[model samples]
Target: MSFAISSNDVRIEERDGHTYLIASSRDEDGNYNHTELNLDECLGNNEGSFNWSGEGFTGSAENIHLSIEGPEQLPILRAHLRDSEGNTHDRDVNLSERIVNDNGCLVFQ
Candidate 1:
């Protein structure tokens, strides 16, 4: 599913054995700057829930892509996916920043 963040809202998506959290803001140029988080690692730990945070931007969705990050902050990009309740069956995803997209679609970073 899709979610809208009123320039300051945080968004979370859980789907296909994974969870995605994104914090985004708009820029004067009308481009979205997004900070994304993957819950697979935390969820794999069997933790009930986890929190995520990131910076903000000031724009809209310029492009969509899947973003993957490792412990050292390495990023991997891919397509997007649809999020569903089954995705969160094992863990809870939380967001501390604003999100613009919450769908489970694979988005290439």
Candidate 2:
């Protein structure tokens, strides 16, 4: 129902060579509802900025930057979003655990 605002609130999962970016939170029923994005389709390179807006997701982000660094090229995401009420939020997430160094290429695992 809301945006995932921290590294701890986000999770990356790899399945059948596809990488998924997931965020979850509890609903009014006390059940966890998940929001997922397919990174393989949206993420074109190691580092770039993107914007996403739609229904069933949270706030619309005007700027969502993704970058990879260090020896292994681990991922880091910074997002700035505006909610329906015009409230703004900024989020920074370190997504290193799901990224693996395969030989020299950065692969999602």
lDDT of 1 by residue, 1-109 (tens): 1233323334455555455555564545665566556644332221122223221110111122333334422223222222233232222222212222334322322
> Which stretches of model 2 miss by more than 4 angstroms?
1-59, 97-109
What TM-score does each of the candidates earn? 0.29, 0.34
- Candidate 1 — what's its lDDT? 0.33
Which candidate leads the pack in lDDT? Answer: 2
Candidate 2 per-residue C-alpha lDDT over 1-109 given as tens digits, one digit per residue, 9 for 90 to 100: 0123222245555555555666554444555555565655543321222322212122244355565546544457665655556665676545554433233223345
**Candidate 2 local accuracy as lDDT?**
0.45
Model 2 / residue 103 / CA error / Å: 12
Error of 1 at 85 (Å): 20
- For each candidate, C-alpha RMSD in Å? 14.6, 14.7
Highest TM-score model number: 2
Candidates in order have lDDT scores of 0.33, 0.45
